[model samples]
Target: MKHVPAMQSLTPAVDARYQTLLRKLITKNGIGGKDSTAFVDDAKKQKLKTDESSIPLPVFEKGIHVNQAPPTSSNGLNGNSPTDDSTSDLSKTVSSTQDDRANDVKDEIMRNVLTIPMLKYDDLKAATDNWSDANLLGRGGFGQVFKGVWLNSLVAIKRLRDTDARNRELIRELCLNQYRHDNILPLYGYSFGGAEACLVYQFMACGSLEQKLRSKSHYPPLTWSQRYRIAHGVARGLQYLHTMTGTPLIHGDIKPANILLDQCLMPKIGDFGLARKGPYGEERTHLKVSRVHGTRPYLPDEYLRSRCLSPAVDVFSYGVVMVEIASCLPPIDRNRPVPLLSDWIQQQARDGLDFASLEDRLLQGTPHSNPGLCREFVAIGVHCTKYSRGDRPTMLEVYKRLDNLEFPGKHYM
Candidate 1:
């Protein structure tokens, strides 16, 4: 019997059994001599494999031991150690997975911040204080206008209850004309999130010209000078829209309610929801003239008969508003059934009625109570409300006429 080394006594029974099994495995695998020594040396250089199937063995005095399972291509086992390439590939796969997760997180964050699908209902509710009745400013055929505060700034919000196609078209047209001039209301934004559509505008403190004209206590009537200034301002605004912009904008629904006043009583056109761009060239026939789309009392005969409306339609509407400003009466007075405003004006012209009555009673105390200037304004209104659209002065002509008019104390040329 061979004398076993003293170091072998320190090995466990399982280790000794594994060594015996490894010897048998090496012989069965046809490993011997230098090849056997090489396999043993390779095995001794590595730590033990964690798998229970791997045999354990002690190092020889020469630091060599028989390999139970040497590195083999078939089993992917290599002396109880992983290859450099295999370890690197596994690390790369883990790193790529981490990178993909990071990219997914980044994409999700961007989608949340940048793109807003539609205005949220909660955000709108909070902005408008749940549409409180106190916020109500005015009502129209379409719906109500409300005062709202957003980001600590006052804003006017127009909510449309009517879902008419014409109303939708009007909203689209107004949005397109946002940058035309300061005389037109500035559209800050709009929301169509819920069943109802709402438009947001820079708030005008003084409200509409109609409100000022009809108010008794909280609101005061406009003086003749203020009225003249408003008329000129509105005419200039309309002229700017009709001629100066890249595309002529027609205020299809020009009325007193649509004319808003700023803090200094400067007139600014509002409610372009019914506005439309004029047809080009000979295709003017393509323009649709609805049956009396404007106020009945203010509707020109050409518009009443459904004739092709030009910018003159707006002129006609402005004329009625002008008359209303001068007379302090509603455009249509159902109580006095004598004639429509146009007919009454024609009769006044025929019978030589004094034009002084046409001046607003509120203007009696103002320094602008000059009968000569009042007559010029009445004449301008008369020309605007003419029976024929051709006879109505263009907004440009209106602006020039108003610009050249001389007041009692001030002269404009």
Candidate 2:
């Protein structure tokens, strides 16, 4: 067994930002003569009268970048709001002080997100044939994806729709470590191409799980063995994110489309723009977002009511993905009223439909000639999507259970 050091941030530039903001706040409040802690306490007592964000503070919230509303904390203690309890001047000032300190921590983080060769716009343009339609892979809400070559290596580059106000915070959060996993996609580097911002990542030759599931010819529906490996790999990737060396990170968006496959049919989870940190120095295991994002079927019942997110949410999404992987079904089929595969499958089970009936038509063998293993794989999926968060298993548990299920009886890295 071996260990690699987790990445650490280096933000000397941000270290001095707090003192500057602290002095500014002191001067603005005319509290230079008073003790800082005492002044803060007195200010907390005063009620806020306005709901305006007139103050420009360098506050950072997970998944929020430029032009996004600050996240509203579950307890209403963090985030910015347009109401009395949320937007009071005292609260704003106090929150800003904390934000400034956190910003320094974030600065060092963004600096080391990815360390690799930089790619200029010219390089990307040349590789992508000047962003030609021929190189275009697909277009989505975030931006357009293209297949290109740089330094003799193929790469997938995302050209964001809004260069100025998108995903910068995510890039920094990702900087906390270099991702090297059998399942997670590798982020090469990002670039500012004059009027646009683009992110570069290793090219997955086989496209996405959604594409393959939708059309079997999208390079052959994966074999039962491949599906088993993909399932375990995706689980391992989720576990890595949840219990990695650093703070727990919730993938926030987990779906088949977000799961890209390499030439060998290995799945790598991508699209982290909606990612979030679970908690900070608190007993809570979840955090609220500015708003709910991600596919509805994959979202848990609580998230539909409130935007609160935790590792369980990721597990829920993973379950949906696992269902699709096993049954070759979409997470949501609009043709059905319930739409969610979990709901649909559960209904079938209620009617006494057995495990053999649940396998995807394209899959071969008894999931490596072991019917119990096949049932267990799908059973784990069902357990992961339990309505109550407490009932759902942790990703580590899910991964271990699947790992023990066996995959062609070979040792995996």
Candidate 3:
């Protein structure tokens, strides 16, 4: 008689009897109950060991196995034993499957982020409150600008008139170098799939310098010191854009209306759709631009004559700004062929006029006004406005001269 295991007793009585008869025959064939039980238990233990060994170790975190292997029995219990080569092949298959799954997950994440939907035409209309007149910030040659809020971020959206391929290239270039300067309006992104093209930029709170300069009756007039700082900031920004290496950028248009101010009165240069880069393979020397851009009063005479422009063109524009700051006069008058402001300055310089009359009228009632300081500013202005571009000083030199000028006493008039 063979001692059968208790688990075998759970099987049907008839099957148990049959297994018992087979065990007896094996015993007769020189196999005993103890040897058989030992062999069965050994087979169970080996299968359990293989299952434990097949469990993969966690790669990233606990309980997160990357490649797990299937369980397989070994020994005479199943009448089949897995070969060492089969085990190795199973492991390679499991690893490859896990790798493929990981790659698929990575691809899915990248696709999701890259395909984030841009603003559609209807979406923009809704965000801008149906392009209401109340939301209008300003308008320019490109198109109208609007103040909009999206995802809690305030943005200035420029709705462009034309969406040609050239304009698209301009947007790409501007966006690429948007992070180059702190005093320039940065391009966040753009939308051009609809009937209108739109450019997005960081919102400027205080509007443009033109508004500030022309707002004598409404907002408080900017002081002399404030104007000087604003002018310095603008010069530094232009210098960065014009002189920095790796494809020099030429701001074809520079004017008061294009200079924006923040709440702290810091000036920021904007509107670069008309900017041009120097020719390739050529060292980024001064640009020889031929286009007659910028406002007439601010335009250098060389540019008017179609001479190739250099950074001096910007310096010439800065000189015009200096005159505006000094005299508090508008840059142009439609009624007059020549701007009264520039004509007056040229006339004064020719007559060897004194600096007293050039002082801004806003300083007339201020007790801090100093005639000597005014003289220094006027002299600097004269040097900047020299008829020849070669005679004009660089923005760096202009900044230093302005810095050296002494400010009057708090109560000195």
User: On lDDT, who's better, 2 or 3?
Assistant: 2
**For candidate 2, lDDT tens digit of each residue in 307-362?**
45678999998988887777777787899877878788777666776665567766
**Could you give candidate 3's per-residue lDDT for residues 212-287 as a string of tens digits?**
8788787777776677667777877877875575444556567788888887788888877556543223332243
- The sequence of per-residue lDDT tens digits that candidate 1 reaches over residues 1-413 is 01111112111211222244344445566555566555445545554332211211100111111111222221111122334463344334433433333333223322322232234445556778988889988887768888988768898877777454424433343334434576888776555555566666778998888888888466666666787878888999999877864346667777788899888888889877556554334324223222234566766665454334467788888887777777766776666664477667766877887776777776665665666666777788888888877788989999999888876645431
Candidate 1 lDDT score at position 413: 14
What residue runs in model 2 are displaced by over 4 Å at the alpha carbon?
A: 1-97, 113-116, 167-177, 280-282, 364-371, 407-413
Best by lDDT: 2
Error of 2 at 413 (Å): 11
Error of 1 at 39 (Å): 71
Alpha-carbon lDDT, every model: 0.59, 0.64, 0.58
Query: Which runs of model 1 end up more than 4 angstroms from their true locations?
Result: 1-121, 166-175, 245-247, 282-292, 365-368, 408-413
Ranking by lDDT: 2, 1, 3
Candidate 1: pairs in clash: 170-273
Residues forming the 10-long window of minimal summed lDDT in candidate 1: 55-64
Better of 1 and 3 by lDDT: 1
